[model samples]
Target: MKMKKKNKGGLLFLMSVVLGGFLGGFVGMFKAGAESNGIILDVKILIPWISAICLLIGFISILLTFNFLKKSRKFHSLYQEEMDDDLNEIYYVQMYRNLEFGTIAFNITTVAILLALFISVSEVVILNRSNLTLSLSFLGLVLIFNVQKYFYKTIAIVRQFDLAFFSTPKDVLEYINSYDEGERQANLEQSFRILFQLNQYVLPVLYIFLFIISFLTGEIQLLAFLLVGAIHIYINVMQLPMVKRYFK
Candidate 1:
């Protein structure tokens, strides 16, 4: 029995999960202590800093994802030449797809953060959980499990393809194209389109409404939500120009 080498993207995800879990746990402990002391968490005192941190993390992750996508695009462009040799196209393809999946997972995590911020600002406790840290830790664990499951499933599917049999560039191209075609392509396109539209239009309008309400009511908590929305809008705008290339 031999252990398989972990994919680099998978390793990065593992690191992120571990880091996120620890951070969440630490924050949870502080939150628990604050609650125990009968200290009401001041949104004005805390949310701005927390939101700033979240925005920084989100931006870094988005930048890394963008770089990975650019690299994958480059690889695809040169894949024909690379396939002419004995290079393992399967490995490259798996790596590319893994990065893509990682980006999607990160985006999902960012959205979750935004949702949490929204709920906190609006004082809507859907889960009746008073500890923000515990909630964050739970979210981290859930994301970790789901991301690992997806990566494993993707690897299994990639393993099913006999890349060694593809001796010609045409064969490699066909195989890659086939994988990107049909239902997968349609779903990917649809998802991207929806995301683009939501981020491009719906989110900005929603944020404007929230911002105006917050300003009128003098709610400091909404600052975090507004910041998160602004960062998300910037990210979406940056990625819009590349969407066609990404989905193509």
Candidate 2:
């Protein structure tokens, strides 16, 4: 089961990278073609498409949030039962380490893609007075915020589990007991829900704000932002099921 999960994660990572690359390349080609034809595209052309995609993302996030709530209830019940059973400390420690590694890998890939996009788009931005450069740069900053958040959270989890792994079994059990309490568990669930919920709302708002800036400034490189936004949404949404599975 663990191996299967690991393989599934690898596949997901591969698919995300491929999809991102394809979208980036497709936009680059379109821009090149447009320039060759002596026709400059307006950012306004992208507003409807971006808005539609954002709406779709918002709808999906709402559904996922509802599903997550149901899963959380099931998870809490399962967690309580597990706490009463003969728990495998080694299994949990390994799980945290795996999660940490996966997070690091994800962050690395995301940063790589962001850098590539910036490099590819910078030349076009510099040549044109459009706000595409500024919009993408701002989006990059938002992506950085998300990457840092995930990294910090995973690091904390890894550290906690690392300590648990080295401690005596009795100490590990004590720590688990403290962590698995009703209040602590509820807080954990709430925190997870809030983090995703914040991303769901905050990201669309930020993107819309950027869209306005791009539209007004006439520097609309909507394709890049759309691609990045899609990837971001995809990653976050994809994690919901994994989060549910983790608790299971």
Candidate 3:
């Protein structure tokens, strides 16, 4: 009886699953928000709260998932396998290099946007620069780029791992956490199933809210924004499977 080793497959599977669904669901939420539900508050505090809540949840979910994976079959092997430390480090570093770059870029851009937005909100800026459209567009770009970056990285991780597997079966048993190609595909199918179910429920309700809010507020511009946001969400959701399968 032998213990399994930590395979890159399981890590890749989970990353694809959670991140795929997370991205879809998050976009769905934005779509829902864009539908004019007539949500109103102190702009000063409201904007900050919106930003804070998302950033908090992103960090928290990552942390919680890290702990859960540590307990699940997804964890690295109890018995370590021998490897060159430098090689191991290099492998991980190369895989994660873009992820690091993306994060830093996202942070710098977001901070700049926020500062510009904050300045625009005050009388100090007479340029009328901040608007609903600009804010939403930036958010939309962030969502697209963030998801794109992760999927690109995920594919690279999978390919590199597959190549590594050509050398040894250690990755087959312990590295992948199981000896089933079915498991890899299962991760993807499960994520889409959840996403489709979620979108089916979310989109209609979001639209209804939009219709009602525009009527109540007498702001037809809100309707335009809602339409744009919902379209973006739909495009992302509908095309995501194709994008996911491209790596195959």
* Clash count in backbone of candidate 1: 0
User: Which sections of candidate 2 miss by over 4 Å?
Assistant: 1-187, 235-248
Evaluation by lDDT, superior candidate among 1 and 3: 1
Question: 113-190 in candidate 2: lDDT tens per residue?
Answer: 454345435534554424443454445445555544544444344334333323586774554555546646865787
**lDDT, residue 208, candidate 1:** 54
By lDDT rank, best first, the candidates go 1, 2, 3
Q: Model 2 clash pairs? A: 130-219, 131-219, 132-219
- After superposition, the stretches of candidate 3 with alpha carbons farther than 4 Å from their true spots are 1-45, 65-74, 79-179, 221-248
Decreasing TM-score order of the candidates = 3, 1, 2
Can you give the TM-score per candidate against the true fold?
0.32, 0.28, 0.36
Cα misplacement distance, residue 222 of candidate 1 (Å): 7.3
Candidate 3 weakest lDDT stretch, 10 residues: 71-80
lDDT assessment of candidate 2: 0.53
Candidate 3 residue lDDT tens string, 1-248: 12233456567678867875776676566556756575542235444445444444444433343333233211122112327676555544443443334434445444544543453344224543344534543454455454434433443343333324133655534534432486557656876886775566556546555654454444554755677577658856778777889966
Please report, in order, the local distance difference test score of every candidate based on alpha carbons.
0.55, 0.53, 0.48
Question: Which candidate, 2 or 3, would have the higher lDDT against the true structure?
Answer: 2
The most accurate candidate by TM-score is 3
Clash count, one per candidate: 0, 3, 3
Question: Model 3: what TM-score?
Answer: 0.36
* Better by TM-score, candidate 3 or 1: 3
The candidate that wins on lDDT is 1
